[model samples]
Target chain A: MSDAERLFESLARAIIDADETAAVQLSETILAKGFDSAKAIERGISVGMEKVGDFFEKSEYFIPDLLDCAAVAERATAILRKGLAKEPVSRGKIVMGTIFGDTHDIGKNIVALFMEAAGYKVLDLGKDVSARRFIDAAVQWKADVLAISTLMTTTRGNIQNVIEQLRLDGKRESFLILIGGRAVTREFAQTIGADGYAENAAETIRLLDKF
Target chain B: MTDISPKERLDRALLGKPTDRAPVVCPGGMMNAAIVDVMNKTGHTLPEAHHDADKMSDLAFDVYENTGFENFGIPFCMTVEAEALGSAVDFGSLECEPKIQKEIFPSVHDAVYLPIGAIEKTLRAGSVIQAIHMLSAKHLDVPVIGSLTGPISAAASLIDPMTFLKQLRREKETSHKVIDYVVNQLISYAKLMADNGAAVISIADPTATGEILGPKFFDEYAVCYLNKITDAIHEIGVPVIIHICGDVRMVKPQLQKLHGDVLSVDAFVELKQLKTELGEMRTMGNLSTYLLEFGKADEIFNQAKHLTTKGIDVLAPACGLSTSTPSENIAAFTTAVKEG
Candidate 1:
């Protein structure tokens, strides 16, 4: 394997192993080797995080494993983010949150973390986010995809409300409305006129890739 | 089988005794059934009823009366215990349920262990207990379920969830202490509800699933602490129902350790498969709340029929019902179970 390829493999393994120090150090090592920062993230860190997401999808990784992997990716990416800030941003801006009335953020957080690694600039509004705030942020950020999540049935309607507001304001055509959560389903997405629906992180990546 | 009251049927079913029919209920807090139809029809909306015992009781009754659910569930949102404990909660408007605005502390190291009595002093806690007491006293035929957020979720509510979750691995000693303390507080809260005449104590631990904690920590924290709470609740003469969110496959081996009277799985799990694994331990649910919230009434009724035939001990939405769920859909669900 080439130097960058070898470094990426080691970095990916570090994320799979949930070793924060190893991930950080290896990430720094890659940068020192004059490796392409974006390539390192996509091929190395992003691929590593995808494996974690896959483990989570297959029920092999639990919350701690998922969180630890996300943290490792975050730690490593922090290094690359600084270097890449001056580069041309290719991945689209995505605004996401656990919709209003729903407080659960684990699922949303996982998606956000994975999206960040995959090169998307994710603007997370956190939990209990209002329909107005979602629109306001998306408009202000000029987002490509507006991702909404919720764990409760009570708050899932807020997704429709946000979408309605987007359509009412005539901005619906501008942004892709992607809805997800424990309570959100493909049927609900279709019912509410969402542009896309992902059941978990892997599906989320697929949807974003398509977008 | 004699035609028993809904409360009797639920109580008997919970205790492993024979019942005429499986009592369908959406216990308040996480599984609240106070949909917009019922609230709009009654004009006793939330953010108002969430604080007043009478309004809370009225809304609970509205759910039971309108939807044909055989029980009255109180404290319509899961944020209550956390809010009562110390966190700030944003009680949403007419169409929205309450939510935790932010956790009180940053991490387990920063946690403030409140005296258990402090929760009872909160108006929200009082309203939950009073609603349970009122329902239990007023209705002789319908069960009143007093629900509390489970330990891991409750602990997450008390602190920044992301930070607290990381501490579950990094800060082992403090994390266990924090969880143990949270579980104790829940036990005390469950006792108060039981002492106030709650027929069943329901605990929803969405954050404590094997999918989140993995099997080892699921066994270590989720099952261990839930068993503690259920053991304590059982001592108080109340059967406990435990709901774990997400697919149970990750934690399947640890399932045997969960001691709640009824093990409620989410929609992702197969109830028949869980029953086969459980081998006589009562299984409560696996109904799709997504279908309840978005699917047609006929489809929901058909799904409910499918779950009923699977021999689920209690009929309930797979998880919490959406506030916008039409009353007719909920009625179809309850009607299917009651008719069975």
Candidate 2:
């Protein structure tokens, strides 16, 4: 294998192993060698994240494992982002947040990080975001999809509230609506007029492909 | 079934002893059942009762009296322990529960050890204690469960959760020190609750679950700290009900090591299956709060009946209740358990 291929393989393995130091070291090595950092990210770190997503789907890697890997991937991204920021290649655009009255954002944050890793440009409006803000961000960003997440059941109604607001503004058809969190279910998505549902961070990225 | 008091029924069921019927109650923190319509109808509400002992007890009573829950769970919001530990809080509006606006320490390693009794002396913590005292004194025949945010959860709240969790691996010693400090504070608070007449102590450790922490760390951290709190509560002659969020299957082996009086699992694990797996250790909950919130009244009742037949020792919402869950549905859930 080529030296560049070897470096990329090691970087991907470091991410899967949740080795932040190794990821950072490999990223610096790639950049120092004048290798394409964006290529390194997409071929190296992103490949590892695909494995993380698969582990999640298979229930082999849970939230804690994802968190560790996410932190590792983030360190590598910090090193690689200069090139990535300029090129700005993205598969899809999504605006995501937890609904109003819900400050718990771990799930939302995980999805956002993984979505970014998966080549999606995500505009993250953090926790306790209002329905108006969700609709407004989606429209402003010209997002292909809007993803809403909440751990609490009380703010769950706010998902429907956002949908209703979209309909009121005649923008309901403009963006695909995806909803998930601890409290959300497939039935809930149907009940609230959401276009699709996701159970976790991996599924969120998977469902976004349909949009 | 012979008529028995709510206290007798739950207490008996808790000890893995025979009971007239399985007690269906809602413990606070993550399992809070104080919905909006219940508050609207009764004129007893949270974000207000959350700070006053009288109002807190009044609402706790209202939930039991109106909703048919046998026990009273107090201090409706989850941010109390975090607030007591020096996190800035935004006590939410009438329709919302409080949330931690910011942590006291920016990182877990920065966790400074507070003087003992520090948590108990906080204003809202005092209010929670007094409310339990009032409720237990008034309704001597009903179970009064004083709920506390579990130790890891309290620790996570005081430091940024993501950072705190990373520290558990990266900075293991400091993380344990922080969790130990939180556990000490919880024991002090729990001791005060027992002294003040909290019949049972319920812990909702949503952050300290196998699904979130993974199995090995869950055994090392979640089970270790929860066992400390549970052992202390047991020393005070009070039964403990501990709720761990998400599927418990990952940590099922470690769960057997847990010493809490009752182990509460979320809806993903059927109590029947848990019964077959764990055998006779007394379990509570598995009712899907989503089902309670979105399902028809009959649907909830049927689910409750199914759980009843599964022989769940105590009936409760799988996780916290949504404020928007209709009173009629909750009423049906608790009512079905009682009637069936």
Candidate 3:
């Protein structure tokens, strides 16, 4: 096998193991070996993250491992993104945040990572995000979809607030609103007037594709 | 006998005094549709009223009045402490229970140091204290229980579970420091609740239980800190009741060793085993939320009878009832307790 191919294989293994240091070292080696930046991200980082996600779903990998793998993938993605941006961007853009009064963001972050791996340009608005901010970002970025998440039953009302605010402001139909979280059921999402709801991070791409 | 208050019945049971019958206690874990309907009939709604101290206390009283549960507690949700710590909470609609917004703490590093005065200014904490105050004032005849999240759960709220767990694995000192801060804040809150007349401080530490963390992790992370909080609360003269959600069969003995006076079990566990393992210490719960949410009145009655037959000192739903649970199920369980 070529050196680039070997480096990609080693980086992928490091990501599955959640060995961030080893991942960084392997990523640097791949870059030194003149590996294509986009290919490294897709074949090295994203491939490994997919395996991690699968392991997590199967219960072989828990939350801690997922976080570490995500971190490594993020680090590698950042380096490749910088190099690849000189070329044309291929993915569509998405604006994501947790609804107001809902500070939980891990699920959203994981979803964001999955979206990025699936080739979506994610603009994360962070947590405790107000409805206005979500709408503003969606409008400003002309994002195809605005994804909002809330883990608490108490803060789920904020989803309605976002939808109502957008409707009141006459921007209701401008961007699709995809909502998902522990407290957010498909029925609840529909009742709150959300455009879509993904069951988990892995299903996010398919849900977003519906719009 | 008709005039005997639910509080009085519970007190008699706690004291091992013979009653006209076995006192039925809902134990403030699950709230089926029947309970919500009864609560709404008594003029309480979700979210808005759940956070309003007077509204919650009134609702707690209604649980006793309508269902004949031996005792009731206020602010029926668990996120009060985390919400006070600045974590965003989703107060679900009519069909859902409130939950913490998980996206707020994207990483463990996002867990900012809460200021010394932050706890005092938190909306949820202030409301909870108010609920405790109102319950204390209104229910002098019954034991008023105040619930709080444990340190690990609070840490989970500050950040994601994965991030928090990762921190425990990689940054032990930082994790312990964060836990220490959380424990101190919780102790102060527990003391305030106790001072306001909470007869029992219910420590709801679901995240610390065996379902999520094994016995070893529980020993290192949950038991020691919980013991500290329990001991502190005990020093103030109020009993502690530890409620660990999910299957806690493994940690039953360790929980018994904690400073808590009562150990509440979840429905996933068998009452017969808990009764044999727990021996003499007071215990409550084992009713399934799914059963209460979807089962017929006969199912609730049978479950209650089954739990009573196993000798649970207190009867309650195994865990907090899903917000959508049917009221008849709760009423059936409570009614069975009264009849028993």
Candidate 4:
């Protein structure tokens, strides 16, 4: 096998095992050997993350497994990004956050990681995000998708508020708004006029891909 | 049947014995029904009710009086146990439920193990106990449910949850220690509630789910720790209700082994199928809160009737109720169970 193919295999294997040390080592090896960073990210890290996503969807990997894989991919991607000649071509820019009054963000965080691994530039606004902040970030970032999440039933309404504010601000058509979480339903998504709703991290990427 | 008190009805239903009908309720903690309409109608608002025992009792009673829920569920939100364990909690407004602002520790290894009985001394725990006492005294016939955050969830609340979840595999030893400590504290807390006049204790562990922990950790940590609390509550002669949030399809076998008398599941799990699979196990819930919040009253009533026909022991919300959920919809839900 060629050197680049071997390094890609090793990098992907590191992510699947969720081994940060091996991921970092292989990332450094890729840079030192002067392989294309974009190809390394696409073939090595993204393929590994997609596999991780598959494991999660199959219930073979749970939240902890996904989080660990995300951590590994995150560290490896950081090293690979340093070797990029210019900004890599973006699939799209996405803004994500847990809606206001909700502190839970694990689901949102996982979705953000998956989107980034799939080559979307994600601006994660973090948890307890207000409608104003969500609108502001999406407008400033010129994001294609605004992904909102909330775990609590009480806070899910904040998602509707975000959608309403977008309309008032004349930016409702600018971004395709998506909502998901324990509290959000596909019916709720449609009722609130959201563009899309996904049930899990993998489905979130699939939905965004179709758009 | 007409003479059956709420407590008697619930106790009988929980035992899988013949009851006048299914006991309809919203077990507190995560499934609390202290909605805005009830609070606003009574002028006993939250953020205040969450801390003041009298207001808490009054609001819980008002929820029962107005919403058609048959029991009084104290300490509306799930943050009581987390706050008692040193996590910074944001006591949200009348409209928003409380949420954990920051965990006390960053990692399981860094967790400061408080004494087993330390939770009893916390003010929030005191308020809950006091509220249970007040409700028990004021409404002798109605059951006052004491809600607890289960061990895995309480531990996750103490340590940064992201770090805690990852450590379930990475740092098994410390994870066990932290959750064990949290479980011990929960046992004492449950006992305190029992002693304080909580007729039934409900433990809602949203973090301990088949989807999140999978079967292995769900067995090792979630089931183990939850059974510890359940056994302790059982030893106190109090009935236990265990709510496992999210999907349980992966851990259904392990879940069958839980000592909790009533198994409350999320909205998606078909309670009828669950009842058939886990025979003679009194199942509590599977009603969609989304329907209660957004759907029509007649539809909610139809769904409630569907659950009743399936012979669910305890009729309740599948999970937490939205603060903005209409009282009329909740009324329709409970009415169907009552008419059965």
The candidate that wins on DockQ is 4
Question: Can you tell me which runs of candidate 1 are displaced by over 4 Å?
Answer: A1-8, A27-44, A79-90, A98-104, A127-142, A150-179, A183-197, A206-211, B1-3, B294-306
What overall lDDT goes with each candidate model? 0.85, 0.87, 0.73, 0.90
Span of 10 residues, lowest total lDDT, candidate 3 chain B? B25-34
Q: What are the models' TM-scores?
A: 0.87, 0.93, 0.71, 0.93
Q: Docking category for candidate 2? A: medium
Q: What is the lDDT of candidate 3?
A: 0.73
**lDDT per residue as tens, model 1, B1-340:** 6778888888888888988877788888788888888888999988799999999999888888999988888878888888888899888877777777888999899888888777788888988888888888888788889988999999999988888887787678999999998888888888999999898999999888776788888888888899999999999789989998877886788987788888887887888878878855788886787788789999999888888888788988888777888889988888888779
Q: What is the lDDT of residue B317 in candidate 4?
A: 93
State interface RMSD in Å for all models. Answer: 2.1, 2.1, 4.2, 1.4
Better of 2 and 3 by lDDT: 2
- Stretches off by above 4 angstroms in model 4 are A85-89, A151-164, A182-196, A207-211
Candidate of highest lDDT: 4
By summed lDDT, the worst window of 10 consecutive residues in model 4 chain B runs over: B272-281
Q: Alpha carbon lDDT of residue A137, candidate 1? A: 97
Better of 2 and 4 by DockQ: 4
lDDT, ranked from best to worst = 4, 2, 1, 3
Q: Would candidate 4 be rated incorrect, acceptable, medium or high by CAPRI criteria?
A: medium
| Chain B TM (all candidates) | 0.98, 0.98, 0.89, 0.98
> On a 0 to 100 scale, what is the lDDT of residue B272 in model 4?
78
- Candidate 1 chain B — worst ten consecutive residues by lDDT sum? B278-287
Error of 4 at B148 (Å): 0.6
* Model 1 agreement with the true structure over A139-192: per-residue lDDT tens digits: 999999899998776668888999999989999999999988877789989999
